[model samples]
Target chain A: MNYLFDLNAFLPGVIAGVAGLIALLIDSYKNDHDGIYGLTVVSLIAALGLSIIDMFGPVGEAWSGMITYGGVSAFGNTVVLLGALFCVLISREYLKAIEHEFGEVYAMVLIATSGMLALASANNLIMIFVGLETMSICLYVLAGLIKEHKIGAEAALKYFLLGAFSTGFLLYGMALLYGATGSLSIPEIAQNASSNLLFIAGAGLLLVGFFFKVSAVPFHMWTPDVYQGTPTTLTAYMATASKSATFVALILIVSKMLPAETAEWSEVLEVIAIITMILGNIIALVQDNIKRMLAYSSIAHAGYLLVGLAAGTPEGYSAVLFYLLAYTIMNVGAFGIVAYYERQQGLDFTDVNNYAGLGFKRPIMGVMLSIFLFSLAGIPPLVGFFGKYLVFAAAINADMIALAVIGVLASAASVYYYLRPMVYMYFREPHKDVPFVQAGITFKGTLIVLTILTIYFGVAFGGLHDLLASYYSGDWVTHLTGN
Target chain B: MISIDWYLALSAILFCIGIVGVLIRKNAIVIFMCVELMLNAVNLSLVSFSSHYGNVDGQILVFFSLAIAAAEAVVGLAIIIAIFRNNFSVDITQINLLRW
Candidate 1:
């Protein structure tokens, strides 16, 4: 039981963690906002680089098998770090505009990023639980950052209560699985996996916990409220980075721990996916508030990712990973623009009708917003469409053609809502004058990078898709078992 | 000399009570307490299983769960206080500013 202190395996999380502590120290002593911001950006970029390096490096366990490095974990870390980087870049402007700029925000973001990194690479249930709690607690506080605001308070309270409630189910599920299989290590659990009733129940509860965190339907009631009430930029972090981390962990659970021989789990996931896709898209169609609309859209996106998981093939899993990267890029872009709009002084700034003629006022933001929305709708020649294409193609390859068709139809129906705000922005005449705030250079530059990524990945997604697909080519299981 | 089933059944009942309380309770504090009860119920089961299996993993997990629960309680209580200050109530039904 020798423990390995593999620095590369833990470097990304450790960098973020140490930076968070230092940011807090600086906040208390110097209270320099720019200093904290610079620190966050530097550490996140360094970690992002390391994670990319890990993506190309070897894949194996570290720290006595508490976590894995390289390959899938590295890929997941890259997405999470990318999401956090964009969110932090955009947050300073938005927070200052709202007159709530504080040093603690940077610390919390870094700490949460650290937690997400841990969750992404976790090989043991203990690591997963600790990482999740670490992330969830910071998020609960961040949601209520504007403590004086009533909606922010409500959002934080709801998120905390529901998050804690879900943890109980998750822990109980872990306890049961450990009892049934006599192990907590994911690969070992898979080795001893069976179709017994106890194992099935534990797995079901585990799925429930994962489904709740990912905001799947029937467990998604908290999403819109929380997303709408939290500060727009932080909501982007929650929507993209946190969801990517959880989905990656879920992929590991489904591929490694769940019994492969049984079709029952995949069947259950398929039903949930269909329901999630239809219900999420239908509900999103009616939301007038832009933030609420994106909230429902995120749930719908989760449904599409679940389709890949339900396919239960390596191809399906790889598609899920690729879709996660595409999703992180476009969602952060959408929310970035939303935060930009939110900074303008108007009570109804988030209302879709208020966006009329905004396309004429700020041509760049208007166009970027349109691109993000179009990508979200899975339109052709955009990354979002390719993401949908890969997931559905994987489903079809796995003989789940009906699931793929339903997914296509649901996304097609979704085109209406995604376009509604674009219509307001471009087609309609200005009704109310919401003064335009000048966005910082960094914010604009980040959006430009994201916009480029959306179009570039749309056209040239093949190589990235192939790289992700190679991670799951079956040898990693042997690495996990230490063979 | 008691069988493990008795302990498991008791733990299950406690867990169900916590779930029901969370669903039915209106007070945020009460709901938070219910969530803690659920965690403790799981802790109890973990302890029983640890003894049954002669391994310390379940007990170690219980300790971690306790620490996590404590952290959650601190944050949850702070949030509850913030909400209370804003609205003068911890009743979840009254906190519907962002409803769809």
Candidate 2:
């Protein structure tokens, strides 16, 4: 509980910022591609390394009850940094293709990632809003970075406008909660939970805003359009990093701030989760675009994550963390292939038909994408199934039997659409000769790491479960109750 | 001449109007105005709650929220301008390129 400026608390942002500066400087210089990419990789690696150290090392102290730090905060940041690294790797060919490429995409991502890190560790409501905006504003621009393209500009507009609307709701919700509880610190809010109409309305509005961010049903109209319209690499970043940050924030609210009123929030979340899962998977079945399919699937996966959230236990939170980790790997890997195909075909053939006979045309990339899709569909002995298993079990443990049933049905419904690309690659005949683009060393390195992690988590589930259990062992609630 | 409950009720009605406007209106500028309305509703409640609690934190939050509302207005309008330049219309329905 020492109160000197903990370098560990700020080191990740510093690293990301400094790395971003280096990339920016390189862009201003000789415009050498290798140097820019090389510097970016090095800085990201350094930041990744430092972030990992802070996570496993001693790093947090209670900041006047506004914030506390420990393993859980570090774990979330580590996930975000890993996401940033993969995003940088995937952006190589994606940015190069649209002729609107700039080194600044890397900088924007790193800066936004720093914002995410800040958010994960936020203990104060003000800190939460600041971090949320920081993460979101960068993504808003990144979504439309292709300023010259019609779709890209439109996507950016939609994201920004809707994002602002949701933020308004979120802020108002926070205000009502503050009025009811007379506190803005999460711990203090939990300490003052009331069942008044104002409190209920506030919490309800707050969750509606979060559901929009997580692309849950009824608020998910923005997902497909944004995903399909934005550059593939940025879509992957949004699908992963934005989703992770929001889920972590949701976990904080439910686990720390809403315990006294769990029944109310749980009921609301149950309905949202059921609708999200069904609507997401059912709509995905009809998608012809690979990117759009993944977008809907991402929504479905958000539903699965919500199942864990509704459980209202430490086990549920940990399961969500694990599932998000698994989802990141599979989803980003699928989009990695999309980026690759865009480079090879000189067009983003998100259409399923364009993937016909890609299995033979580019066997390795095709196979990897197939693996990602299968894992996403919850194929057994893959990472995604494990993610589903942990979450569903947590729901059942909490006696949310009906929710667990809905989750299983959605996973089954998901299989048909997820396997469509694989069917195209393996079963259909080639219509034309599509040139295969060579993945640079960086892209290959990322794919290899993600694939390994996906397989490892799928097979070594017990080890991960034990690790997560220990990581989440702290009794924050007891601390709140002064027990 | 109004009771606290009446003021709160008025604020709630104004807030609902704003939320409906945001959800149903497609004109970018009008939607922006609705967002402003929602913020003002919260401000109304915050002021009343401040007097009720006899505390100043709620008022301080009101000031802070006003600042944030201003910031949001600036950013939202800037984005609207960009969208207009690209699409030549403020009708949000034309922004359908990014919707499902």
Candidate 3:
């Protein structure tokens, strides 16, 4: 492989950084944050356009194979950017309501997004480390951006400590991998697998790090606190886009670099997937706080995504992509509603009981949130159902009958907790007036678009699956052959 | 007469100590420092590998990791200060405002 610095592969990330810098430079003199906010959104849309355009172009190598384009990585970046776009949409109003509407939010979000874009397409282990750190540091600051809140401050500290520790494990794993293989590129490392205990241990440690980032079982201690501690809008962004990017990087490595040891990884993924699903759902059942509940639900959803990974087939890979697309929309919408409610009542108004008779009092919030909840529960005629269906099908296709059965049982158990909010919203008598702020066009637009997408993908799921198939044949397959 | 294995072994030991510090330490800043220690150990190992293989990639990667570690420390300290402002302490136990 030759080393050449190609700018095309870095275009999306570059544009994002440029946008962030523009926001910061203008923010100091603009007096009001309106200009900064407008510029930030415009640049985000521009980056989104670049990602879409790159999808159709021929796959290319950039930075001497440190990053790849026009395949799963490209599609993954597109999804991450779109998720960030929705986050910005909902965030504009939430920040304003909380009196934290500053240029830093826009700049930090863009910086974190560029990092995610880098991580999504990274081709080398070194690039992955840099990307992860860039994304995580921004997230730590974003989580604690509301410094006046004790919980926000506390949450940031815990997340910073735990996240850095996990990153240590990741760096050590990369070092061991380099020691074992004498290379940093995924393709080169794959070709040089030595089947030594050292290599196995390195890979295992790497999985531990990845699992921590994606909030898998046993390594998920910080997730609930971090999710509940961050301001609702930032939490929404973290739970969806950041988690998806981490999984994309994980899937890329598991599929691209570890095909030689798929058997070894499949066993590990299978066990973790089952435990993650069961434990996440079971624990969610006991949480009274809505944010905490959704945190565990997000973990369970990660488990379902892992089932697609454990299948270890092309079909499974596409299923993971499709599930991520569906899951992002629904999760963002769910968290948007949480933020809206938290803003209306108080920052600490997170108890499910507070939502009693909320459906009758505030029909719009109730209906929209119910739609998100039902989608999360994997109910029919919603994107989450289709996402779950595809992953379960992939598991069964791989002859993993037990895994599929367990996935089904876990989904069944999850319905209770998922409906807990709905029960308080509709079935119970009104405890207090559940008036919500409904003035921001950005907030309303985000809900409207996400609701349409949730139902649109749910009903016309075939269109996406077909498009994914074409993409698989057109770009990813060619890139693999070229490699 | 130190071979590459000696460097690897020494780095590995330092890495383990860092991990223990992160797990066992209660002071937020100390744990944060331990994380930096772990990252430095990795840098040491990477440098050793680069020299043994006579490739510039690992050395280049060490530079990237060093920069990232510094960036991380800046962010970590900022967050610790924010926590300290809110609670007047950086002890992990004292910062427990979120539980589920």
Strongest candidate by DockQ: 1
**Distance from true location, Cα of B47 in model 2, Å:** 5.7
Residues A1-483, candidate 3, lDDT per residue (tens digit)? 333336667788888888887777877777558887887788889988988888767676688788888767778888889899999988988888889888888998998898998899988998888888888989999988887889888888888888999998898888888888889999888888777876787888888899999999988889999998888888988998888888889988997787544237898999999999999999999999999999999999999999999997778888999999988999999999888888875424688988888788778878999999999999999999999999999999999999999999999999999999999889998665545566477788889899999999999989668766565575556655654
Model 2 stretches with alpha carbons more than 4 Å out? A1-3, A17-40, A57-62, A260-263, A346-348, A474-483, B1-14, B43-75
Worst ten-residue run, lDDT, model 1 chain A?
Answer: A474-483
Best-to-worst ranking by TM-score:
1, 3, 2
Please write out the lDDT profile of model 2 over residues A185-267, one tens digit for every residue: 88787778878877888888888888989999999988898898778988999999878877877887787788644346887
Runs in model 1 deviating more than 4 A are A1-5, A474-483
DockQ for all models: 0.89, 0.47, 0.85
Top candidate (TM-score): 1
When sorted by DockQ, best at the front, the candidate numbers are 1, 3, 2
The RMSD (Cα, Å) of candidate 2 is 3.0
| Lowest lDDT block of 10, candidate 3 chain A | A1-10
Candidate 2 chain A: worst 10 consecutive residues by lDDT? Answer: A59-68
- Local error of candidate 2 at A471, Å? 3.4
lDDT of 1 at A185: 92
Name model 3 segments beyond 4 Å from true. Answer: A1-5, A29-31, A346-348, A474-483
Per-prediction share of native contacts kept:
0.85, 0.43, 0.88
